[model samples]
Target: MFYERFTFRLIFKLLFINALGWLLIYLILKTKLWFTIAGLSFILITSVYTLYSYINQIRSDIKRFILAIKTRDHTLNFKNKSTKGSFPDLYNSFDDIIKTHKDIQLEQDAMFQLIRTILQQVPVGVIVVKDVKDDAEQMEIAFFNEAAATLLNVPAYKYWHRLKQHLPVFTAEIAHIRKGGKRFLELKIQDKLIQLSTEVIPLNLYGADYTIISFQNIKDEIEQKEIEAWNRLIGVISHEILNSITPISSLSDTVNSMVANKEYLNKEDLEDLKPALQTIKRRSEGLLGFVKDYRLIAELPTPELEFHSIGGILQHIHVLMQPFAAAKNIRLQVGQTSSKITVNVDLKLVEQALINLVTNSIYSLEDTENPLIEIDYRLEQNKLFIDVADNGKGIEPEVLEKIFVPFFTTRKNGSGIGLTITRNIMKMHYGSLEVSSVPGEKTIFSLVFNYV
Candidate 1:
């Protein structure tokens, strides 16, 4: 519609000027007069100037409209009193387009603000790292929330590349995450334990990869678990002590009554009294041993942390369990994914933990044909893991839950304090003991060590 109206106006102006030119030529030729020539000259010059000015005005108006839109000048009004016919319609269309763009811009800004507010209010820390467009190896911190700044002890405005100077381990871990490495990590930063997770979302914001990392401080959760575990331990200890003490108390009372009635007792009664006395002695000794084990759990020594070879630890464990593995006909093997991998741990303490795990694996393999116990170590995302996996009668789900509780045992004549002590040793070295099992299939126990 706008084009048709513009064409009609152009054609009308051209035809009107052509007719005027024809009339001027006719008068100049027919009259053959000098005065007519001067008059026609003046009229033609005036007509040409008017035509040029009109065309220039239209061109200028169109240019102004485009400039206003390009500069996002919403205050410019295109409605003009001099602009008649279809020109006004063209001007109004331009104004409508500018208004629509402004409305969309406002909506987008509001949505962006809302998203930013939500991210800041979330409990978990959020960090967005974007690769630098100019430097392929460099990365910048595009956005980070208050929680992220506080948890990382970094200014929200600082770029990630600058963190290498003060927080090398953290920076390296983030790089590892961005490279599609490990997805989850539990790290000790300063004195706080943080559980960090990452999600890589490919963003074409500037033709570069970006990663979003979320982390939370899990120290409180761990402390709560420790409290619950202690409560369960207390209950188990109480039950075990009562079981041993109740029998001793009744046997002692029987012996006392038999000795007190010496005049009424026969030879057979004397033999029965002797057996009751021996039973009491055995129960007393058992109670004493139980107390000793409980003391051991309470007095676990602090680890003397140092770098230790993973291969050496596994070799020592393999030798220690050689006899037991042979007796059970279990194939015990030790392997590592890398020979250079090492762990910062207390050699004696970690060795003890590994031995306890291997022994448990050995015991589980009893009565199973062609049982296998594999001890393997691997390094991942700046962390080390020593895994003891066994193909045997796996642990029951109910029993697995209480395996870490002190004195909670599923085995006959088992002390049940071994796993408890092993876990404590791991904790001392700034590591953790994790276990997973499938009944009648397999069991895997992982010793996670933070290498940093």
Candidate 2:
């Protein structure tokens, strides 16, 4: 209230002083009696105006300072060069303060930008959560590259899935792996299996923890292990073949020399020699058959391709096996014949495979009463399916896994290259041969082929 009244009184005094001073100057110039009084009054009024203008300038500078502080820019200086009195020192001090504040702010901004650049190029998926406990935790996902997306099987645009929905089971598995100190955990989703590696590190601020997860595909590694196993088995089989054949050939030569020399002269010796010679002959024949089967495993034939109707091919197999089925008191039937189902296959190789399958079925039916073999073909969805089903004593689970393996057999005189050769031939034709069996019920062998 006093400031307002002072301003009003100052304005009134200035107006009245100006009017009275002008009147005095005019009268003094006219007469020269009160010239000194008018000069003194003019000087007093000029001093008051100068003081008022200086105070108002100071007020305006203070308001500008406050506005700069509200905008968080402390680098604005107050410049009042016209005031060369005691207030010059105050204005210079405020300018120095502004310079100091500007330096501090610049250093802070530089440090923030440096940290941002480091996080942006960290080469890992870095997620920063500002508040760990609250639900409104601000999350920033950064530094996910193309390789990371491919490894994780996540699309580039859609890197984040709700943790529970995409891999609920696998997330639990990953947690278990983390607790156990395992480097990675493999999990299957659809047709793809990914290995996830997780790590927990302390956040730089507020003593919180953040988790980082990395993903990789281990399917190629699994395939490499399987190939190594197969190669090792092949090496062992080759060594065994060498060991068996070297001694057999030496013994056969020794027996031939003795028979040529006719070393036994007594009647008892001759009688014993006859049975011995017959035993040797039978053993040699069996050993020779074994060698042939082993060679067949080592030297598989390349498929010779030909195009033929699948129905006619199965019909030919049925006719070829009529005698064997009849001998075993088994009925052979073929059905579901499609007229135009054709496949590019090695006819000779496929025929041999079919013969092997049918022969195995017949052999399995020795003790079965009223056994029957069915050979059929069908064209469904542009693929040819040939099925060979038999009602016989089915194979055990343990034996089924080894059925396609070379020199693995359950039969008394089985050479065991039959199924191995069959599977190889089907693979050469770019088809697949699958077998399913129950313990005492039917056994099925399905040959699947896609039309070319």
Candidate 3:
């Protein structure tokens, strides 16, 4: 205000002085006019200094605004008191915008923190993948808690790419369930069987599609199932074996008593007695074999761990079974893995289990044009899984559940001890044997060893 008024005063003073000079010129008409020129030069100097000061103030305000933005202080304001003629309203509007954005940012931060807290507290694995919009991709990982990180094996800085490869199989499965709108799925995760549930939602106010996959470990459930199966098996075997043994013992004792009585002996009677004795003997032998099979389960041998390569084992088995398979016109193929893997296992027991599996596979391949048997091994999450698969007329779904039980057979001439003994061997080694079959497609017997 002072500078503006001074400038106005100086202009007026210059006009007055010029008018005075003109008046003098009109009256005196012969002076040099040096005093008027000096006064005008002083005015010009003062105007230049004031203009430089105003320019400096404007520059400083601009620098402050930039600094505020860099420091994330969006609410910072610069209302230039010196900028004259209608600028306050504009500055006020700009400040309002900054305040609004700052408020939004605070709200967003709060929401993220709350979500993070919930995820960290969750017991089950919680995996999240956010959609990347610019590339029109399905999802990327926006957040992963500790449980999720360990479950998915996600490493720092490589999370996005890792998620890209793995999450789709889970997401697609989840999406299918969501289409039906089911809440849960029985799944296998890292050698541990589990049930997983998923929810699709938007993340971070950006409308990125996020999937939350939560999984419950079902290891205990599977253990319970195995226990139930064994309990039922024991009950049936005990009842049936006792029933057969009681009558066989009683008949043998009666035959011995008749043979000892000389007074009742006759040719016709002796002939009938001989047939009866022989029938009893044959039944006794059959019962003994049955008891032997049953006792194998009761007297299971403890496993002695030995390091053995699967490839060598399979190669040896393939050679041993080659002639048998060739006689039956069956082709046995060994699938290769990345490298040779040595596992701590009982060699004899594992071999016996695998032989039973291969035998079962061969028996199932009756009517197929090309009976193909495949033996493959894989390492997932540091667990070794050996799969014996066959292209055969697979077992019916209704009977698939009972295939592992002792003495349960659909075949006419089968003792049904192969798979039962196989399961026992796996149990001794603290491993699992799982059978999956689809009619007319394939039957897979997966022997899993999670020691490593």
Candidate 4:
């Protein structure tokens, strides 16, 4: 009803303007009078001007609304809110439109600032750039974070050419892989050697090509890891050497005392000497075995890569170890798998790793009531995992931590190098060997093929 009333008012205004227009024209054509015509002409001009002003008000308001948005001036407002006011809906709509646009702009600005703050605060150096010329050397740096400057020990560079001059060798490596990849670089900074781990990523955002280079100074991290590795190796080696030498040292002194008191051994003395000699022989052999294991773990060979069906490999291991499990009355279950599932890995190395895991499971089941070992494959997040799981007395948490540490063992006569050698083999194949165990329920050792 309100809109109908407004439409009616517009019609009335148009009719009034038309009537006055005809009247003024008729007076000019019929009378052509001097004083009366002048007075009537003035009224005609006033009526036409009023009509134009009334219609033009809407057009003028539209122009003002657009100008407010163009200039981003939020202060501009339509004051009339009552239904009685002219074009009340138009005024209300303008206010709502401005508010919506203002909110959208605010949200975009806030998001951009949040990302900027995060990138600036991160420890990894970052730089986003776009190629201005054919070569990457002539590039424009779009985003250079604070970490970039700090890690390089240089001022923020806005162009690739400027940065190239500052760190020529580092820049060269970056140029080599403008597409995308990762590498570790050795560099000298202020007469000190540092290792830098760097990566590049290429992207096309909103029809513009961009490259983001992220790097970090990993010298301290690498050095710290090396120190920890040395400490572990030395500690294990020392412990093993002492364990063998302690018994032999004490036995040697007793045997020597016996010899010093006698010219030759009588039957009683000879029997005593035999057992002591046997102990010395056993300990000497144990020490020699430990050295061989040390060499095996330290000198792991590079994996020979080949694509092999996962089902085939698992099937082979089952056939080979079935007898060993059968002897202990344990079930060796190989899970059903897809024939198409395969991985790029060394056949011998992977088989060896599985054998080690299965052997450990077999040993764990010696005292358990109903023992079972399950071999299976799982696909997760674009990677394949081959698992050897067992239901036996599982590994304890304290021992699990050191299970991969070379020469660290929980069982008597355990060389303890099996797991370490297995882990090294997976590393050579760009994969990983992982374990998880519950105290009394289950233990799972996964040989994860990550790169494949």
Superposed on all Cα atoms, the candidates' RMSDs to the truth, in angstroms, are 9.0, 19.7, 13.6, 5.1
By TM-score, the better pick of 3 and 4 is 4
Rank ordering of all candidates by lDDT, starting from the highest: 4, 1, 3, 2
Local accuracy of candidate 1 as per-residue lDDT tens digits, 42-134: 877787787788778878877886887788777776666226545667777877887887888789989999988999998778878787768
TM-score of every model versus the real structure: 0.60, 0.47, 0.54, 0.76
Candidate 2 regions exceeding 4 Å error are 1-265, 378-383
lDDT of 2 at 12: 75
What local distance difference test score does each model get? 0.80, 0.69, 0.71, 0.86
| lDDT for each residue of candidate 4 in 211-291, tens digit (9 for 90 to 100) | 999999998999898898789889999999999999999999989999996778899998999989999999999999999
Q: Which predicted model would earn the best lDDT?
A: 4
> Model 3 over residues 1-452: C-alpha lDDT tens digits?
44465467557756665665565555444546667555655655565565566556656755775676567688576455424422445456556656777888899999989988988777667666555657635346666677766654555222455554665665556665432232445555566555554444334555545555566554577679879987978876776677677777787787777777576788877886877778777777877888887887678688899888888777777777778777789998877633477888888888888888888788889779889999988888646889999989999988987887788888877887888888888877767898888889988998988644
Model 2: what TM-score?
Answer: 0.47
Instruction: Give the Å shift of residue 241 in candidate 4.
Output: 0.9
RMSD of 3: 13.6
For candidate 2, the lDDT comes to 0.69
lDDT of 3: 0.71
Clashes of each: 0, 0, 1, 0
Steric clash pairs (candidate 2): none
Question: In model 4, what lDDT does residue 264 have?
Answer: 85
Q: lDDT for model 4, on a 0 to 1 scale?
A: 0.86
lDDT value for model 1:
0.80
